[model samples]
Target: MFKYLKNDLPASIVVFFVALPLCLGIALASGAPLFSGLIAGIVGGIVVGALSGSQIGVSGPAAGLAAIVLTAIGALGSYENFLVAVVLGGVIQVIFGVLKAGVIGYYFPSSVIKGMLTGIGIIIILKQIPHFFGYDADPEGDFAFTQVDGENTFSEILNSFKQISLGSTLVAVIGLAILILWEKVLSKKAKIFQLIQGPLVAVVFGIIFYIMFGSTDTFAIKTENLVSVPIPEDASSFLAQFSFPNFEVITRGDVLLTAFTIALVASLETLLCVEATDKLDPQKRVTPTNRELFAQGTGNIISGMIGGLPITQVIVRSSANIQSGGKTKMSAIIHGFFLLISVILIPRLLNKIPLSVLASILLLVGYKLAKPSTFKAMYAAGWKQFVPFIVTIVGIVMTDLLVGIGLGLGVGIVVILYKSYQNSHFLHIEDKSNGVHKIKMTLAEEVTFFNKGAILKELDSLPKDTHLTLDVRKTRYLDNDILEILDDFREKAKQRQIHITLLSERGEVENPDSYIEFFRLRPKTA
Candidate 1:
């Protein structure tokens, strides 16, 4: 993992920038001490990153879990007791990993996975718009359309235009221009440009710009619009920030229930991030999901013991890492160390960097994820994939991450069911004489209730003078529902003056026997 330091170090800086505001924002949203988010960030990066089998996935506090964390803390009576639940949650997650529950990530359709990435990309772009304009009210990590601050995504963006910060707007535009030039031109021209990422350059430029413009009336960004890492007044205050979990609370029934909830939710969320990261990986490497869960569990355990929020693999940070050219887990590991060292030593320096510059970095990442070419490519892949992909993007945009994913999955399942219903038979129609037709219906290898509607519709459309043949020789399984439909259709055929013949593995019958007995379907074979 350390072998990719050249790429990893630069990428880590980008992720560190992305993770910083999110760490604080999620902690703030969860009603926890602001420093706890930093603690989680450190543990997620160092502990989880070191242990994970994923090449590009980065772990940290998740906005999706904020509500749960908030309620759990209040329900548990104290933050220390809440930490006990977190530790127990980590233990439960470890058991889930041991049971190989990570396999569930594999079951997500590829379309849904692509949709997730695209949706997240769109979200990043939307969320960063306000920050890009130097709007400081909404937190950096709130991805939901309806923010915790009670403003919708688009409205916040509209409001940003009214409260524009002059220095921030200028820095953002210049920072974006530099990033675009560095990536699109300089990087291709020289290897040095690739090693020194655009984001790193943009951030340094932002810092200098902040310093240079402070005395000028037309420039100088505000303290609220800059990166804020909590600064401890003294060494003793810094030491007091870490609060140990109360292990005695582990025996409480409510604590155990909350632990199960966190384990379940955190495990599911981590699995999703793992899947998204694997898809986003340029090399198309498959991460070991179980190892990922184990690493997350370990991270959470450490985080809780040290006054941090519970941790999970986060797609935003992971995607930021990937988009910034991270090639291995080393980027994630280094970013965690960056978080640790930054808080301890360079909190004031970090506080000088403008959020608008970081917003510019993420805007490019967002554009890359939801590029127009990606949309066209997905559209060309056929509706089965395209529909779900589009739906996922829309769903994620309209709601939050998991709900959007769930919506896309729902659409994907409908597509599967529709396809399954239409694929159970081949129908051949031929006009043999005046007002007479010969029709052949060949059953598929596996026929079930899903095929009942298609078969019945075809059978009902046969003309009075038609001679129909039902071929079941290739059919291995037939649902009772289809058999009943066939039985009803045969009686209707008699009334319509239609001639019917049945052919099966057993023998030929001129519609003289029970449809069920004649078909002789064994569902087990299917």
Candidate 2:
């Protein structure tokens, strides 16, 4: 893990900066104590990173789970009670891993997965825009269209325009400039630049800018526009941040239901992230999905025990780590340590960092994920891949992560069914001989119910005095419904004066009396 210390160390710093605001913002979005998000981030980074098979994936409190956590907390009557649910959720996730439920991630279409990454990228860019101008009404982690602040995504953006902070905008502009320069020009030119990282410089610049102009009326960034880490004056106050689970309420039906919900959702999100992160990885390494779930479950268990929000493998931080050239899990572990140490030693210094600067960093990350080139590439993949991809982006931007994925998956399934329907068979009209139309219909390898419509249409349209050659030689699996359809077509053949010849691995049959019996007697294997 430490082999790539030079790369991982800098990447860890970048991830640390990226994760800090997100931890606070997600906790705020979830309506839990802000410190809880940091706890989850710490546990997720250290615990999950150590245990997981993934090299680049980062785990933390997720924006996708904010609404769920918020509602669960209210439904369970208290945050402490909700912690019990979280603990239960972790146990359920472990069971899921043991049951090998991670295979569910494999079922999603590649188009949908691509769409998910792209959609999230677009959302990040859009969400950060408001914060870029120092309008911090919505928490940075809230990706849903409807916000906890009673403003939808678009409305919040509109509101941001009305309340723009000049000072923050200026700092954001300079910070972004520094990032672009460092990444595009400086980093490539010098090893020192790569080791230092552009994000760190931008953040440092933001802090210095804040200190310089803090008292200026027009140029000063507002306290609300800055990172708001809870400052503890002493050890007792720091320890007071931790909240324990109300384990006595663990037996409640609501607690169990919430736990199951969190486990199922968190597991799903983690698996999806695993798939997406693997795709993004330049090294093309595949993480073990079952092991990932187990790691996440363990991390959640630890996090909940200390009053953390529900955790999942978060794409944003993971993507940041990858973009920053992190080569191993050490980056994630080190970032967790940074979080642990910073909160204890320099919470006040952290609070001085501007949100706009972080927003600028995320802006770049978003652009990389949702690059215009990606759009062209997706479109070039053709409509089967493109439709679902676009739908997913739209759904995610308009709603949330799971809903967007659901929409994309639904579209993907339809595309599969359509493709299956179209490709189920090949029909060729051979030249007529002896004034009789000779047609050859070749069934696909696997003929299921989806092909019924296409096959039935072709059969019904056959002309009178036709010689129909039904080829099933290459077919490996034939559904009973398709066999029944062929059987029903026999009557039409008789009425149309069509001669039927069945060709298969078995000897050819002329005008078979019972299609079903013929197939049943000569089993598919034979």
Task: Give all candidates' CA lDDT scores.
Answer: 0.89, 0.93
Q: Which regions of candidate 2 deviate over 4 angstroms?
A: 523-526
What pairs collide in candidate 1?
none
lDDT of 2 by residue, 200-271 (tens): 999999999999996599887888899999998899999999999999998999999999999999999999
Q: In candidate 1, what are the lDDT values of residues 1-526, reduced to their tens digit?
A: 6788998999999899889988988888788898999999999999999999998999999987888898899999999999999999999999988999999988889899899988888989998999998997887777778876788989999999999988999899999999999988999998999988888889999999988994478886878899888899999999899988998877899999999999988998899889888888999999999988898889989988899999999988998898888999999999999999999999999888899998998898888888999989999999999999999999989987788889999999999889988898898986677778999989998888888888888888888878888888888777899989988887898899888888866577786557866555434443
Q: In candidate 2, which residue pairs get closer than 3 Å at backbone N, Cα or C atoms, i.e. clash?
A: none
Which regions of candidate 1 fall more than 4 Å away from where they truly are? 251-254, 434-436, 464-466, 487-501, 504-512, 518-526
Best by TM-score: 2
